[model samples]
Target: MYHYTDFDRQFIHQRAAQYRDQLERNLRGELKDDEFRPLRLQNGWYVQRYAPMLRVAVPYGELSSRQLRVLSKIARDYDQPSAAVYAHASATQAELGTPHLPVGHGHFSTRQNVQFNWIPLDKSADVMDLLAKVDLHGIQTSGNCIRNITSDALAGIAPDEDIDPRPYAEIMRQWSTLHPEFAHLPRKFKIAITGAEEDRAATAWHDVGLHLRRNALGQIGFKVLVGGGMGRTPVIASTLREFLPWDQILNYLEAVVRVYNRFGRRDNLYKARIKILVKAEGQRFVDEVEAEFAQIVAHDGGQHTIPQAELARVSKHFLPPALVQPAQAATTNIAFEFTDKEAADYQRWLHQNVHAHKNPALRAVTLSFKRLGFAPGDATADQLCAAADLADRFSAGEVRVTHEQNLLLPWVQATDLPALWLAARSLGVAKANIGLLTDMITCPGGDFCALANARSIPLAAGIAERYQDLDELFDIGPVDLHISGCMNSCGHHHTGHIGVLGVDKDGREWYQVSLGGSDGSSLSGEAVPGKVIGPSFAASEVTDVVEALLDTYRAQRLAGEPFIASVRRLGLAPFKQAANAVRHETRDGGQVLHVHLSTVDAATD
Candidate 1:
């Protein structure tokens, strides 16, 4: 709910105008493909298989209703017609209903941005124009720069928050937007901040994750972790600073990035991320960053100083909206009643999607975009508008995008949850599966992404469909199932309780399953990375293999134990045995090959 200042608006408009001019020049042949490539990528445009993909930034996953409406309008006006080859990430076009827009629907990403898959090059400028009108842009969304800063969706109003981290996140966003010193690094960098005791933002998976903490004297500061990432090599970040004073966070961050910029590998793109540098250098890397921090502070008093007034100014923008008194709201809603089915469903929804808020009268509700047989992170234009309208009615015209690819009305009054749930259900965005296995985090796989080695959408869909039953899902309990199309780890597969990675095997798609990954802080003091099980399986056999893993968990798990905890307790022996035991026969009678399902284009719901 941060409002754009005059300076902010001017900066965005200037960038949009510059990009427009640059795009026109490139289209007119004044610039070659090589010349235009970096320019386009910096603005979040990618030339994929069929057309350009434009990823628009939604800072820290916060958006106003007006902004959401503008996004919906962009989909309606500039999107191309849906294609058979690339429809929903989960199901075929025919099965999910052919989307009129080229991108089918706005594909929400794990980074809290929505990607348009089939954006035409010429019209990308128009898309930029549309985005500018609503205080949104694609600045720093791509290229080797600090991408959009992400924080907990429940930042300002989470019950356990020690301090609101959004202001700090915004402060970093402002400072890093176009910092010349670190503009072109060895590779892209990412940062996440979590204000709550719970790690909703998956801080450990980011290049730098900051957990806001309060000292004994009640002064807020940060616990910094660095070098964590997922790709060909996934590694958990290590402690950079046990506690950094809040006011000096910016300077500390600058020092860390500087160290990475100076030593991060430039020889190979595969080894370019800060994670690799940290791994290669070990404790030496941390020592260098600390030394840099000291030098920065020693010279010129302080390179970066965030005054209290500035913090107040940013915090004001994130102040929670006024809400009705909890007692009054409870009394008013107490008179209401529900039918048997409605009561049961509401209970399930309340248990799953609804979460506690800092204000007693208010509750944060997660609107599940992961419906049965649909892509994990997709929202049609109509659905977007509907969400905007709902937010307007219930959440002070503000909505939030979760890193998990769902919409959240963070300031909904507890009394209004039933009505909001009904409205969300009507729009097909209300599913009670938050934190459940069905609530998978996935990326646009081989079906839409040219970089992918194998199709991931269909496989994710198959897994979701196989466990579509709510009774089964609830019984299975909380599990994070993350799938990636390729090693880019766009889906953060390495952080899931159950991780699925797509790979190329002699021109065919194969999936490698990993067990016991988690984004949340470990109950065991040490950070754990997901370990890959046995060999990869064919695309057709993925769901069955996952089922086998799940069955193993169910059979061996102790009462009330979560999936990840069970995996940690039992190790991979049981899962490996269960998965190896399940077998599927191929159509070529003599030659046995396992084929569980077809591609997304040919598959049904």
Candidate 2:
């Protein structure tokens, strides 16, 4: 866990004070909406569909229990819609055929951000003050600026790590934060980094991705990728540099963004991402970046080159906390026996939720937030505080927000598995569905987001409703069932094994189903975008269609093949035919319609 320095604390408190002034001025009518909009967005405030939304950045998904408690406080105190706002929002959603909107909860994103959907504008300053108290703020979480830097959730603890990428990610976080030159790019830019051989961070789908590795001479370097993104157009980033010295990463990153800032599209919002620029220019874009890098080095001597001492300073902050020190831990060789039924349940939980840690005595455990009723990744105020207490009791007072929308306790002793499992189960977060179908990656859809065409929460619920049988889920095996409200791909639906994108067809919600996409994880193999099967399915037909695709795989798959492998080996023809066969019109009020058709809700648990 990285501790905040005096400079960091001072900087954010000052920012909080400034935001208070700006917010007060806007409320007084001295600053109009247009002027206040950009200012608010810069601070991660958004005027969403029915209310103001706040996105709080959790750098690389790391959090201290104290910070989690503060987030819990914010959710309990500020994440509420006004009476009028709630009434209007409820009526609007009723017409849309979605479930009643839930409030006073924090939704964790695939990017490792916590979003509060119902916070009022007047209290935004108060929320900022609360966040600043814990050294948390929403800086650059929105707008055409470099967003929060994301990395592998198990960055410092992974067994396969070549170099812990946290220090480097922290370095970039410092460099990119409020950089005046790149403050207003053509559009939002994103970066992901990973030090492990496995691509758990999904770096291939980011604007700029870095893979940390050691060179032949044992010096650290990075393998860089540029232009990968998902939306209307999905691309796996091209290799920009095979090996960039670790020290010069900031300088090289500067050149890459510099070239993009100079040439990226401004006229068309649709074509504004760096992916478009890299695709349009191809080798020329790469060459231009290289030339810029040369110029930066030759003319200015690469002022951003990181020094060894500075790296050491940043690395020390990320070192394992005292609670994880093996010598200080209690050790015993006696193995506790379990009852047969207990053994069966505990083994399943261990297999699904526990991951290997570099430390032999330690294990990384994911607390499943995905269950019936609640939206995936959503934690209520009480749940958030419970998680904080769990972190304090079992995980060295630190919990990590995973990109898959779960909280990971990274320092649990292997011997404490039984006790932790019991505690997490009591907390209702031990669902044993880490990479299962029920553990779907989803975004707050039309119910909350103004940009969405459909609702994802209930759709996710609908799908989850059908998979209540743990035996059936484990039998089907690990699946990345990702959903997005729109083509924005905020849910990374483009890279899901089964990708579902919500679209508006004549003011009705329809879903496009795609197959054979992957996020480049070891389980998912090399990165590739999914291909749509056929015409978009009506919302009513989506759940049946998803079942049809899986049925198709089960019917055709070879022995021991997973869903993704079956999709690749069998091709999309049979799956397409099966999915299309399930599409049929449903009549509501004697009118042909694709109803929102969600079966799960906030009360489903």
lDDT top scorer:
2
TM accuracy, model 1: 0.92
Q: lDDT tens string, model 2, 362-421?
A: 889999999887889999999999999999988999999999999999988888888888
Cα error, candidate 2, residue 520 (Å): 0.5
Collision pairs in model 1: 80-102, 540-596
- By summed lDDT, the worst window of 10 consecutive residues in model 2 runs over 596-605
Q: Look at candidate 2 and give me any clashing residue pairs.
A: none
**Over the stretch 396-422, how does candidate 1's per-residue lDDT look in tens digits?**
999888988998889888878888878
| lDDT of the candidates, in the order given | 0.81, 0.88
RMSD to the hidden true structure, all candidates: 4.5, 4.1
Highest-scoring model, TM-score: 2
lDDT of 1 at 174: 92
**Native-to-model Cα distance after best TM-score fit, residue 289 in candidate 1, in Å:** 1.7
